[model samples]
Target: TEDVEKIKPEFVRSFQFENKLMPSTWIVIRIDGCHFHRFSEVHEFEKPNDKQALNLMNSCAVAVLEEIQDIIFTYGVSDEYSFVLKKDSQFYQRRASEIVSVTVSFFSSMYVMKWKEFFPQKELKYPPSFDGRVVCYPSSKILLDYLAWRQVDCHINNQYNTCFWMLVKKKGKSKSEAQHYLKGTQAQEKNELLIKEFGIDYNELEIMFRQGSLAFWQKEDKNMPHESKGSVQNSHKKVIVEHCDIIKPNFWEAHPSILD
Candidate 1:
């Protein structure tokens, strides 16, 4: 018995890889939809942006925040969402695999479970899946930058897609022609093209389409018993979703608890 026990841990250790996340850092788990371009096409999602699809993603993010006590904030755009855990959190003993897998799996599950709510008329042809990875930032500043960077990307990609789809849908341009037309186009040129060609002012588009979305607690969640298993927190403030500018100092200043 003693001999077997002695060799067992050693054998397991030999085969196992170290996947513990760095300690004392802000942990981020980003989940991206796998092959979502096809997912959207099969589902007939509106070109550029689908408000219902985005709402479904946001709802899943909120569900994850509710389920995971360590996750404090989330930002989502397109088919991806990033969950931010508290810097000092020792969730799952800082195991990278656990952090990524648990959050991402829960998100995917919620996506399926809530699919009908967001798409009441359409049948869910197939379940969607996501891939996740974990990264750590040493300080709050870099973490904020990480989120801001994603928001900027949201702006860039959304602008391009908007123009691309307008060309295809409105002007009867082929995908190839649209892609070629937008090549080497600057932001100003894109804006002008939208105005001159489509008579659409890019600035007048919906705020949610431009800014993406964020999910966070408006107030500190009262720490609940481990046995509590409700989707919604009992606290006065449940997870709130907002499509707001996270790039500015004013946003961070207003919601200090997110970084604090």
Candidate 2:
């Protein structure tokens, strides 16, 4: 009890500081179920032991980490094998969409492959193939609150739920402004009233961002004397937009393939 008391204050302080620093940090959380069918198919193949379960969990975490690394350049893993991106700067619409799509596809593929490799003869089946849903919000506090709620739901429902959430922010907006825009009464109402409001076709944005457009450039002389001839130089900085994640009820339902 004494130790808990000592830690509580520190934890609160840390959270407060984080909220202040990145008030508008938006998180995208993807929750996936792993090897449900395989587990049932190979129920008798491996003994139900804590050590074995832990080993399997560790392996799954490693696989997820590897896949995430392959997709996103800037990301970190939490202790729970969940992925997080803090203060992410790459907010180009294309980049954001690519990150989400690649992550879902990669995780789904690797999860299936890993299960097959582990239980070669189990003949496991996957539910309708659905990618994990992405939840976006403007504040970490709200994100954590939503995660906690989902955790409770999973516990009560006895469902296999694995989540990968990313924190994102718009490039130009101040953290407070972003948070205000996301959390304001009108915005919240809009989000609540609209079904599938967060759903977006990121692939289209990805292709558009990749296509470069023309821009004007000035010429400068290099090889010739300063007065002789002029040379031209062209440069472009990728355009990126900043945005955050918000919580949506029944995110798993959005991706019926994985959930089913």
Best by TM-score: 1
- The residue ranges of model 2 lying beyond 4 angstroms of the native Cα positions read 1-24, 33-58, 69-83, 89-96, 125-128, 159-260
Give one digit per residue, the lDDT tens place, for model 2 in 1-260. 88876776766777642212232345353534455345443444321122233233335544554444221111111112233344342433324455556655655565466655565555544431323444445654565565555444433221111000001121354545544544534433433422233343322322212111111111233343344446333333221111112134443244332211
Least accurate stretch of 10 residues (summed lDDT) in model 2?
A: 159-168
Residue 258 C-alpha lDDT in model 2:
20
Top candidate, metric lDDT: 1
lDDT values for all models: 0.91, 0.36
Model 2 lDDT on a 0 to 1 scale:
0.36
lDDT of 1 by residue, 1-260 (tens): 88876676777779878888888899999999999999999999999999999999998999999999888899999999999999989999999998899988899999999999999999989889999999999988999899999999999999999999999999999999999999999999999999999899998899889999999987755756555664455566678899889888888999887878
**Global local distance difference test of model 1:** 0.91
